[model samples]
Target: MYKKLLLLLLFFKCFAGFAETIRTDVLVVGGGASGVAAAIQSARSKIKTILIEPGPWLGGSMTSGGMCILEGNRTLASGIYAEFKNHIRELYKPRLGYDTTTNAPLVFEPYTGAAILKRITDTVKNLTVKMNTPFTAVKKDGTGWEITIMQSGKAVTIKAKLVVDATELGDVAAAAGVLLTAGFDSRTDTKEELAPQNATNQIQDISYLAILKDYGRGIDRTIPQPAGYDATQYACLNNADIKKMLASAKLPNDKYLINWSDCANQYPITSDDLNPENREATFKKAKLRTLGLIYYLQTRLGFKNLGLTDDFKTTDHLPYLPLIRENRRAAGMVRMVLDDIYTPYTRGSQLYRTSIAVGDALPGQHYSIPGAPHINYPPFPAYSIPLGAVVVKEQENLLVTEKAMSVTHLVNSSISYPSVQMTLGQGVGATAAYCIFFETTTKNLKPRIIQGEILDFKGMLMPFADIKTTDRDYRAIQQIGATGLLQGIQKPNGNSARVLFMPDSVVHTAEIKPFLNEIYSRAFLWFNKEKPGELFTIGNLLSYISEMTLRDPKNLQDGIQKTWKTYYKFTTGFDATRPVTRREFAVLANRFFNPFARKVDMSGKFIN
Candidate 1:
């Protein structure tokens, strides 16, 4: 106890006086897509929010990294992400010929994206954006946190109720002494079959994403040959198929988001990218690599008109931040594995219930060794990012978002899209605000509460691409699908088969009984075996439910009526002989198994 007192005294002594001290309800470390979204949502919640960004601008990859191409399913994006996309459309509709109705042109100039983010934040009350500020240190100060930031060579201290590790590399988590997994986690560590036998710090290549604009014909805007320019490095340009892929990188605005695809713009870096001692040197090397690639494209690849765009002023048209694909991921409550997307989880688990965000990026291996068999992961169902995966273990008020969340390397490949990051950022920020309002830690907070709030915010917790919001049973279908109890039937064809959720078809007792048995340890009478093609009636469901709940089927009339009332609000006129629709089964199954089913409006907007 006395030693602890000494340590506390030392902590106070270290931050006894700083150049400036600021206090806020939340402190966001990075101004990336996730960080910006978090700050926006937190401030929108009427809390004192402060965002500290190392660069002069906001929008990390979307702007600073020149990743103007919007990847992932934009329809699943909600809240701040949706607003940002709409703002982009409004800003570029007349000038760039964007369709105001739909997101026709998913790409934009980097500066335009940054300016839009700045414009939105300027209007948000109680939000402070500290540009050109880098986070240096973080320590727990009583119930809150004290973060030391370096701004303009002056040390600034910020005390906040919560700290969000929105840094692209999980910097805040590192400073706060949180357990982080770097590079490829071992198969034993993540239980992913694709994971390396031994954890290696050799991460996926970081891209200094360059924005090159086409100047039509007869325009010579080619860059001068860069120093150490090697013509042989880009020999893949000779391959007709590879050249076609590179040519297809052109955006609608005639600007190309050149990051990868055999052009050799991506540079493989080790964990040294985050090393404080040699990080700057590593970044410089990466920059030179990209600059060389640009020169090669102009001089050797016969693209003389294509030159760097003037969108990024801070870095002289170069991206401010290198797009680091994989980094130090925080070891949160749930570490997402390959099976989370490829295989279904156990029914009724928290992972199945507490979805905060969703992503469905097709997993591609563009950075690995050439001729290495690329495992093209088939377009998967839009899977959820569980809330438990964002809450950092052993930390009271810290949340991990963006590419730094607790996910295996294999899983991160599919989930690290910029839109998904923004969606998750909003959820994390909202969760922080809720925590402050209720005066509770993230661990003690209930998953149902978080999930409900996210849904209310127009943020999607489930990503069913086939199911529209206006569908008659969107919410019920979503809730049941989330429990891992329902899965789409896969086509029996070859490797090109697509998974389909046949929503309108009548479900059979034999088809769905196994799922029910797995979720609820129920016993069924073996007197009669139901036929494979027989439609599962409402009466058949009620009898099975009765046996599952350990109640006699003969005496379950009142109980069945009560169950129907609880879920469907049906008072009388029940038709037990009627065939059960997929929608009806969804509502009944969700209401019975989901603990927070009471919070959902079973027959509201979901049932259009």
Candidate 2:
């Protein structure tokens, strides 16, 4: 008997050396919306937490995903949601260049966004955040979960008491065999009016959101029609689905609920949504076509195709990655419904005591999925959120994030807005952190207690500004205000105005100087450049930028050269100091985003 027991022990011990175990109190996956918040909260709780993001940049939708607007969290939506906005204010305020309007500090650049996230996250303890580490697979391991992570071309195993799947597509939960519902569940799985009866695990449609850069003048700023660009030769651009909006020109804008006239240089430019199953055929085709759409429009009409402008006149083309507007949502314990926003709750009772975060996103009408209902926003009084929605019903170990979470289809349509989701993301982030600190599941937390924790973590739950005019830096203008980048308030007289922020207004080198200095962008190089005071030409800027910064200067240089040689070679250029419009730089800006690149900066600081 003794010999047999000793042999068994030896057998168990034999595998120890090769285990390569990474033990953490909390393992938060996907560092976009929810994961970032969750990881930050976990670390702030002073518990050991590891954040694994498949992408290079941390700000999933806002930065790398390039969806800059804040979503969800309203006045009634407090907790972790409030804290994220506050961080934006505290960190990005001073760096916002002088605002032409309220002059509130705003950070328009994407790379700057990454830097901000890095700064806030680096301050936490027992937290290891690694990019390009996608969670490949997951499995149940008794009380905890065993997570497999792929990083730098190798697979590593991790053991976490709590695992948060803040992945963009509810990856881990699905991999772990969690029961989930995808696409718009009309009456089939859910009694949602906007859903279809055949909603059989069909996922909601995902679209790629891209930013174009048009520097006012230059042939390079223009888009040469796609290889087959022809007014007569129409395919995807002329598809009845998209053409339906094209005929109305205002349809896409209306569905998005934005006055496009105010978007400045903003126009359509995208590749394929990264999560698309047909990445090579479909996604790649979409990206080229997005630019081609602008090219067609420009060639048809005598105009240019400008890229999305974060700050500075430089071309910021395709989004570092595709924006997954909607994805697989988990089946949670107590799903949130649209009616729940104005809950049919007993007066003194709360709908959910596990309130992890808050939001106020009213769904827009973008019908990628068939039979999607058109939703109009009539202000529902801002409300609170519970932790039940964060827990994957079948798999208690995972938490859904980004565009994926548990919500009644109708309810999701409302909260699915970009601004509101950010708030919700923060809430779950705090929940993950709390669970790590207390060593418990989010299911066990009380909403009031969670609220307290969120407050303690310094996240605020404030209502929408009576005067809302957040700039490129978002609420960041208030945080970095000391640098004098911002002038006065978010809007003139500190009141909300009918202002459509022009994307191009933020891109001046003069404005960037303050941002670069405040964010610690190679101070030595800032002063010691061979091409000091050169015009804001892509060629000129690339010439002196630190090699460390331009990990592959030649590649970026070649793109710019090709673009310039092809387009901008003849157009007049803008003065780096002068304020310009997106329409002016339309051509050059349109191609800034790469087809497959995540962000322009190799350092992972989000590029504008």
Candidate 3:
């Protein structure tokens, strides 16, 4: 009887140790800001999605990296990023005295930020999050991918129809034989004036950020001197004022984010440090530098109360991951460059039509490393990110987000911010869902269908500064802007610039005639009957719509006039003789002609 009981126990233990294979419609192989957004959006689209993270927490740089202070894109909130911002505001506003103003930078504790992300992710249906799970290997199987991940000391295989490579170093993409480029690009290679003359293996400096908290004036929370501590190494901070420096990144709960560069805490990394074998040791060195900085602040600066916070809940009290600014960039269908942001309207490729994400942040780069090339680019206006930028060139069923997407080294500075990355992740999720629903490959996907999905989810297709999400006609304006039927005016605002779509401005025949003629064949015949350089009146717009949609002008006019004041809420009465505003034309044209419904190729060219 004893031997039989022991055999039963042994059999149960053996059965529990067997590895399991899970099937999912989408698999996101990172729990960073972008990965979380991608998984949430993918699941929100009613697809079964799985998100795996090596770390214990979500929001990679925003929380685990101790970069809780968000910068740029103060007004361009959309999709998951907007949801994240709202969650932070709601969680901290009443209790923590957090700033809820529009233009104020978002500041919060690292742990609180991570919690907020987890809360938002928990409410999403069809999404499964696996923490402490590290990606092991990836292989292309049929039209989908078969990925191996380590969970609970066992290998778990996930067969996914679509895969999003949101890893910090693009490890999943690299393992799947995707073409990736690292380091800087030469001016001749990228054709950018601001790029270096020659390419180099050197990348941007990595910051192992530390979060310090004020534990009152009388307490002594100063830590012991870290190993290899040198006073001269931190001589740069000697002359700086302590009060001003600490206020630079002050958080809601008396916490401060120490990601400054004046003290030289930013550590330089080489291509070799990016290797998995060397990465751990490289991170140890960076952490030591941060610890040394913290010690310098406490002992030397006489701030004994400001000590390392237990926000991360780690033994060392340091952030879980260092703030990596650049990483392996995938070579996608189109490589975005500086010229794309500077001149999107008249560019060689009309990528605006294929836009899936919008970013308005100013471009910046950190060159703290020795002998690193520094080239300052002129201020650029808000621009749209193309769908092809995230679609890998070699892989048909794979997509990449965050810093791994296809953009030149120079263009990465603008698109790599947390908000922009989150929006891009949302776009990637919608694109993957569209492909799955249509049962088509990434190469065969149309831009308009994906753009429609983004709009359906209230995601911005164009970065129009003046347009707000609350505006009733926001979707129509964004759709028309994406089609290049209307272009936003780029105006300089202080150091940065913004693209404004002045909807109240009256439309001119010449300004829109060219685009109209290019998009619609009947537009040419209609323009032949109208005079050049004339104001595009409501009567003329109705005539044009009638010619394009082959509808009776009287019926179209009667329907618009009845709904103008009540349903459409147009303040101005429908007068055929009066000149039409951009807003009115966009709404009416969007309803009748539906120019945005036209199919566009990857290059944003209209398909015949």
Candidate 4:
């Protein structure tokens, strides 16, 4: 009996040793929307990637949180976000009458969104996904990361070359010893005019979102009155019309996402609430607030038929995760501020050239927090996200995305949208791939090389509303726009705004000459010698290109004219004397001189 017991113990110990360590090129913690996108992009880039999620479903906000109504980037669809939007459209358009042609906001059921994401992730070759796995600990192992995760009630170790902190609340980054800033910023610290006099540990309001489905007109689907429910808590909803409120976030089918802030459902959070030990109790309070709002709608407003939907597969009908608007932000190489967005072109640091993602949402705060300062600012314009914002300065081989990116609290108001988060994820994924392929650290990697990889994957480096992904000159326009050679014009469109490239407009020498001189040394000599007119003609452009490349002027012009109609598909006949439009100039100059090839550092200064 003693011999048998010793042999059994030895067998169990050997099995534990064998199943202990798993290796991968990249390990992405938290399978949120950004985490999923990062894993997908890294896997598609031909790297062995593993994504781990605490919950069973992917898509933190849009799926588990039940906030399926996508905001911002309606026209700027690029990369995995575009692919996800297409999949949502294809599945729901015919059956649920979803409009696919127009640029309307896309909405869907939360479960369908998660299933679609699962299907998309399954198609990628070098990716491995583990659900019901929670991150436990992380430590540096030489140049890589040695992570411990809880799976099937046992601790499993993972060794990864790089780590991406895509957690909903920047948990991984915090664990990795990255400096984090939470809550409001002071005007003195961020140098923003709109910030308050002092900083606080108060973050944006979070909502425990509930999706309501109409069972039928006669059915009474109202939930039982929740504990600690108080009617006066939702006094703000007294004047709100029930129909109008329900219509605010109506999704596909007869469902509505109950993320209303007016009903006092938006719960305020502080640094204390972010503690893992206290998070559950904190979330419970938020859930109770949402239930109070729901009770107000059902008992008082006479909407008993609209009840919580079983979208998240939770025992309680509420969403599995809360819709977190803000969280702990990592301190990266560059901290993006409001000035970066307000005046991207004229900003002292040309961070626009290092753009990896784009966002056009206006900056505004939820009015749920009492004593929250109200600062009125100008309409927000589309802005580029610098690569440095996602790359951690203190930590090596680490990247943070989603709401945890390195941005000022003021700037986070605009970039926390789901679309921007996904694009940011794709950008960091490409960044990780580049570092792995070249065997370099994050500090040594070039921003333009990552931008090039994103462009090759049909990602938008700059948000140009008029330039669609299907356009033949999309790459040219995006690349040129990144170099600041052709800046976009911001136009107010109803309540929102967009940055138009105005490709059809005629190019003026004065508009581009300043940027040309900044980029090319010979451009100054060409402008001095030619003394070109206000209207830059095709002949003038060709002469400038000749000066830069030292090519034969006549030969360059002849080559451009030949391909002008055949390859470029320009409807207008090639003319040497006529003024060239922005589209014509962008295409020709991009093809011949290739100014976009010039490298820029993280500060947007030309390095070579």
**Superposed Cα deviation of residue 139, candidate 3 (Å):** 1.3
Q: Flag the better candidate by lDDT, 1 or 2.
A: 1
| Residue-level lDDT tens digits of model 4 in 453-545 | 898888889889899888989999999999888888889766566889999899999899998888788888888899999999989999988
How would the candidate models be sorted by TM-score, starting from the highest? Answer: 4, 3, 1, 2
Clashes of 3: 0
Candidate 4: regions farther than 4 A off: 1-15
Off by over 4 Å in 2: 1-19, 71-107, 187-205, 227-280, 305-317, 344-349, 368-372, 376-380, 460-608
TM-score of each: 0.81, 0.61, 0.95, 0.97
Give me the displacement of residue 399 in model 2, in angstroms: 2.1
Candidate with the larger TM-score of 1 and 4: 4
Tell me the lDDT of model 3 at 545: 83
> Can you write out model 3's per-residue Cα lDDT over 87-147, one digit (the tens) per residue?
8888788965567988678788888888888998899999999999998989898989999
Count the clashes in each prediction: 0, 81, 0, 0
Relative to the true structure, how large is the alpha-carbon lDDT of every model?
A: 0.71, 0.52, 0.86, 0.87
lDDT against true structure, model 1 = 0.71
RMSD of each: 7.1, 21.8, 2.9, 2.0
Q: What is the lDDT of residue 115 in candidate 4?
A: 95
Error of 2 at 72 (Å): 4.6
